[model samples]
Target: MNSKEFLNELKKYSNDLLVSMSFDQIFKEELLKLYPRKIINCHAGKLPFYRDRNILNWALINNEKEFGISVHFIDKGINTGDIILQKTYEIKDSDDYTTLLNLCHKECASLLYESLILFLEDNVKAYKQKRKKKGGGNI
Candidate 1:
């Protein structure tokens, strides 16, 4: 019913790390405080850029030539967490939302895996995400 109660329940589980991709829900202060940098997320879109959902379509509708993926520490803000890794994939004229989404599926998995390794090894170096620029993600 509260932070302490929730934490006690969590302690019953042996999960040492929390990383997400399909989890679009926002984590408030209490949960965030539990993990700090240990709470990570592989965002489907570029942080502070194409936030929320429908990112692939946003990129396509905006006539973007590239699609981006970011793995970051999940902060209280909406996808405004510190970035662990960010990489973009080219979007050719023939590509559509479905294609971009598929690309993100692969890229997100790869990036998340790489990030987790770095985290477990204590080799991670996170950087604050900059403010949002124009739509369609910053290049």
Candidate 2:
């Protein structure tokens, strides 16, 4: 389903969950204020340095040493959120875009599933992020 369809369905269940539907930046700011818990998002690539699109393409082009997925809180800027979890897989020198993408997709799926499990069991605190830091560091 498209974003509009998905959002419409989400709105139908608003009573069971918080719902805010607006493209305006102020709406997002308002959400940040009203929501008590963290706001999460799944980034397709390792964040900070790899902030642009088509990360798989970029990773292959640049011949990266590693690639990964990150689950992070959504802040004001792009991919600047506090990282809740990250999982990386080494990039083989001979690896191409397709292979690297498969690895990234696998990690993303695992992390997403794990995050949902934690949310349901109320053990999300197990992966609580450390203090937010600037850009990419050792990981």
lDDT, candidates in the order shown? 0.81, 0.60
- Decoy 2 TM-score against native: 0.65
Using all chains and alpha carbons, the TM-scores for the candidates as numbered come to 0.87, 0.65
RMSD of each: 2.9, 5.8
lDDT of 2: 0.60
Clashing pairs in 2: none
Residue-wise C-alpha lDDT for candidate 1, range 1-139, written one tens digit per residue = 2357777897688776888787846777887777777788888787768877778877888888786799988888778888999998898999987877788888899998999889789899999978764554542
Task: State how far residue 68 of model 2 sits from its true place (Å).
Answer: 1.8
For 1-139, candidate 2 gives per-residue lDDT tens digits of 2245654574565331232211233225545544434556667677665755677777777778887678766665666666666777788888988887767667776886777676667766534344436654323
Model number with the top lDDT: 1
Candidate 1 Cα lDDT to native: 0.81
Clashes of each: 0, 0
Off by over 4 Å in 1: 1-7, 133-139
Off by over 4 Å in 2: 1-39, 126-139
